[model samples]
Structures are given as C-alpha cells and as structure tokens.
Target: MKKFAEIDSINIKKNPFVVGSAVNPNKPEYTIYLLIKDDYLFIVDCGYFTNKRTKVSKWLTYQLEMPKAGLPWIVNTIENKFFKLSHEGGLPKDVYHYAEVVDGEKLMIDRPMFLGTRENPEPGYEIHTNSRKEGRTPKSLNFTDSFLFEHGLFDLFKDVAQKIESGEFS
Candidate 1:
C-alpha cells in the first residue's frame, strides 16, 4: 500500500450529506448516523448527550468512515482501522485481543449489519461503550444484524437511500 505524505492529499470532499441514523438496541447510549460524500460512506457513532438522544455536537465524533465499496471492503476497512488504532494505544488491550482472532473479511456480510466478534464461537459485531471515569475499560457489546435491523437500522439506511434518489437530501 502507498502512503500519502499529507492528509489533504487524499482529496476528500467536504459537507457530507446526512443520510440516515439508528440507535443500537443492545446499547441505546450510542447512535449510528449514516453520511455520504461522493464515493465515501460514513457510519458514524454519535454518543449520547441527552436522555436517549444524541446531540449534533457528537456527530462524527467517532470519526469512522469508508469508501462506498462492497460489504467486504467495509468490513475489512473497519477491522484494519481498529487494528491500527489498537497498535497506537487508542483502544483497550482486550479489543486488540479480540481483533486478532476475528477476521472481518472472513465474516459473513450477506446480512446488513455491523460485523465483528467477541469471545464467543459465533461471529457478531462489536460496539464500545465509553466509561464515565477516565482510564476505565470501555465496555464491548456484541449484537447480530437481525438484532440491529429489528431496532430500525435496516429502515434507516433504506429511507435515506430513497430520499437521496428523490433529491430530498441535496
């Protein structure tokens, strides 16, 4: 892989359109906001600010994004990003341990949901919860695609895509 000398050299566009959003069922404290800019799709984590709701100040706070590629590409990018973050001491040691064993590329992406694994035999997606105290271990929660969809994730993405086609998002 080639490395860019500067972040701006990547040529990312600004003012990404907010497409959709969904709150995690297993962990309601965090919400996933969908955004898009040309060739990029952003699955952002907007942490809780108010009771059972998220504040705009928290949008894109997690800084997670990927090219509008296939499912394999998305999963692989997510795993690779976390792997790099772990090495940089940005994530907990336990997450790195899980990341080592869970190969995102190998996970089944036929289902539309976040993908990952915990200590269990079955593969699933992982979400990290922030601890109020500094230096506390972030809690990792795992859930399936069906679970997320049951809680409105599927509808969120679908509605946004429809809106975009109708020029409602522009």
Candidate 2:
C-alpha cells in the first residue's frame, strides 16, 4: 500500500461568470467550488448574500470505501466558512489535530467552501423566536444543513472508526 505521499497531485478549478441579463428581475445564485477528479463537483458552500427572495442549497452524501490495496490519496478539505473566523487558527491543539490527520497529504484544497470538520462546539442556532417576532423573513442562511451533516452523526463516526480499528478497510 502506498502512503499519502506516494500519490499524484490534483488541482482545483475556478472561474467567474455572470448569471443573467441586467434588469431581468432574476439574478443567478453565485457559487464557489473546487474541481476534483472524476468530474465530481464537491461544492464548498453557496447561497445568496445580497437582496433577493430566492436561494439555493446543496447537500451530498457518499460512502466511498478505499481500495483493497490502498487509497490513491486522502483529502481532508477545509471549508471556507472556517476561515471567516480566524480565532481558532491560533490554538495549538487544533493545529496539532489537523497536522496529525493530514500526515503530509497528497492534496488539501479550499475552494468555495472548506471540505472538512471543525474542532469546536459550534455556536448553535435556533430560529423559532426570531421568526415569531420579525414576521418570518423568507430569506435566511443556514450554513450547516441539518439533513446533510446530521448532528446525530456521532454514532456513525464511531462505527466507521471501529471498522478502521478492526482493519476492515474494504
């Protein structure tokens, strides 16, 4: 089995384009992304920021098992949202954790959104009260989608970790 270092490199692609004609009363939702192999479009994160009643959301799931021999590379993408707040970049343990997991990886790209987890208790959000008071604004942003990145995913992680521990890398 080859190590992460013994792998080829891949690049992320980016480009800018306008959505629609001016004064059309419809504007396209802008996005950022990284181009990986296999034409797999792993959208980082995207949504409307300016004045608009419309929005777009993205969610995906895949259970990709490593090859019996080994993986070509292990990519731990860091979503761009994390960089919006730079306070934790100073934490030693956070730095250590990322370093330990990466172990000199084949690639780490931060395109539209970062593609990995954060090491903190996320300041959670609840909106029943806000909507109750402010007439329920239709346009709001929820970065972490509930159905996609389920908070109830701890058990699943444990199961995967257990499999890895048992050398069940299929």
Candidate 3:
C-alpha cells in the first residue's frame, strides 16, 4: 500500500483531488484534489474525516484524556448531519444550518475542544461568526452577517461523504 502523499495523481476524472495531513487530533490540515475518472470530474476537500481533517490525527494528539473524550464528540456531531453535493446536485442552500445548536446543554458541555485553539484566543470561539447565511434561509437572512457565520460548518456532512466514498477518498 502506498502512503497517500506519494499517490501523486488520481485516476478519477473531473473530480477535484482531496489531500489531508494530521498529527494532532484537533488541528488537522486539509486540501482539495481534482481527479477525473472515466471522463467525469470531482473535487474532494482534504479535510474529509469527521473526527479529524487528516489521517492518524487522534494518534498524533494523544493527550490521553482530552483528545480521547473530545474526538468522538466532534466526529459524531458532523456525521449525524451536514449536507454536500457536486456541481450536479448543487450545494444545498441550507448547508449553514449545521452550526445551529440543536441541544444546548450537551453541546455547551463540550466547549473546550482540543481541535480549535481556545487558550488565549485572540478571537475567542465563543463569539459567533456571522456567516454562511448567504442564501441560507428566511430564518437567518435577517441577521446582518449570519451567512458568513456558518460557512465553516456548512461542510460537516460533505467531508464525511467524500471521505467514505472509495471512488473519491482512496
């Protein structure tokens, strides 16, 4: 089996290639790869996994306590929801709704996740990003910057799907 980095070129056609790197469970780096298979094309973002954006992430950030507890929670949340599609299905307009807090209490308890840095954070995670609401929904359009707020979260499910598909992922 070849290490993913050396794979070089994807046999798929038209699809964007996906690349990812991780050592720490929290902060995994991701990128997109364009691959074309049999005359068709697709784009795969690097941060395709739910638990971490890259491979062997949890192993790298082996805090023994925090990373273990936090990884599962974050991964589970993304897998449960989020939507993604190609230029064909068209990116869902409601994609941003993902960051919406479905369960306030349970969600809040896991605030200090190891993935996103919170220590001495210049722009602390607590402050909501007013984004991702672009063409989001009537419920969010009223907010001044809601469209941009959820932009980061909009890809929750999308990444997982891309990661799972051997046609795109492997």
Candidate 4:
C-alpha cells in the first residue's frame, strides 16, 4: 500500500492490491480502499462472497478507469449527505447515502457513523476492524483511536476526495 495523505491522524493509502480479510466471518464482510493515480481517485469495496467477487471486481476495475469528469458528481454527492450537522454527543439516526452501480447491481458504500460523548468523542471509523460486519464476532486489528466531532471522519474523507478531484495534489 502506498501512503497518500494523513488527515486528522487517519492515514489514507493506495490499496491497488487486494488484501485478505483480517477476520473470517460467517457472512461476507466489506472493506473500502482508497487509491489515487494522477488526477483519478478510485474507491474500492472488497469482501463480497465468492459468487459475487468477480462481478464486484469487474465493476471496480471499470470505476477505476472512469474519467475524472465524473469525479465532481461523486464528491458533491458525498458532501451533501456526509457533511450534514447531527445531534451532539451521539450517533445520528440519519444515514449518509452513497451508492454505485456495477453490472446493473447497486452497491452501497458504508458511511462511518458517529459515536461516543462530548467529553470522549469517538467517530465509528475503523479501517481494520470487522465489527461492522453482520454475523461476525467483533474483532479488531487494533487500528482504532479517539476522535472528536460528529463528522470528523466524514469531513476528512470528503476533503481529501475533493482535493484529489481538483488536482490540488500530485
């Protein structure tokens, strides 16, 4: 994995290569990987069942090859849904909407939820944990840390995506 940028202590990296699941779960688990090449930004979701893997992989490859002209739509969609203000000191009942079509199938991106209190604020952003997976035992690769603000992770991701789309960084 190539390091891209570190936002609010969260390191964004280029995961061009597929990685094995950190935890084995009864149900298929999902993980999102971010990558950038020149002016293009790629977002990949891994861990569908074997039956769905080929289709998902094809979709991801197509998405990775998409032109930068489509990036604005992605950034705007995420911003509108992700940057909304929520109730303080708790996870909001609202969920951010992010969906992509692959082989006519809709695949939704999992937006990190808000967690913890004002004094000990925590955003539900864990890159190496399979706790979010359904029917999976809570397991962590020990990659979690405390964060303040309801939209901390969302804001960081949005900012980086926007910057990359604008060609602000090489």
Give each model's whole-structure lDDT. Answer: 0.43, 0.24, 0.28, 0.36
The order by descending TM-score is: 1, 4, 2, 3
Candidate 4's displacement at residue 38, Å, is: 2.3
For lDDT, candidate 1 versus 3, the one ahead is 1
For model 2 the TM-score comes to 0.24
Candidate 4 or 3, higher TM-score: 4
**Which pairs clash inside model 1?**
116-124
Give the TM-score comparing model 3 with the true structure, all chains together: 0.21
lDDT of 3 by residue, 1-170 (tens): 11122223223223243232122223344333333333222223233234535433321110011111222333444334322343434235544333433222112111222223455222112112122122552211111111113433324324433444434432
Root-mean-square deviation (CA) per prediction: 13.0, 17.3, 16.5, 13.5
Deviation in angstroms for 123 in model 2? Answer: 3.9
Scanning candidate 1 in windows of ten residues, the lowest lDDT window is 1-10
TM-score head-to-head 2 vs 4, winner: 4
lDDT of 1 at 156: 63
**Steric clashes per prediction:** 1, 8, 34, 0
What is the alpha-carbon lDDT for the whole of candidate 3?
Answer: 0.28
Between 1 and 2, whose lDDT is larger? 1
- The lDDT, on a scale of 0 to 1, for candidate 1 is 0.43
Q: Which stretches of candidate 2 lie over 4 Å from their true place?
A: 1-52, 55-97, 101-121, 124-150
Which of the numbered candidates is closest to the native, going by highest lDDT? 1
Give per-residue CA lDDT, model 2, range 1-170, as digits (tens): 12111111111112221111111011124222222222121222232344335554333211111221111111111222233345544323333112121222212221223222354223321111111122443212122223123532223323433444355542
At residue 3, give the lDDT of candidate 4: 27
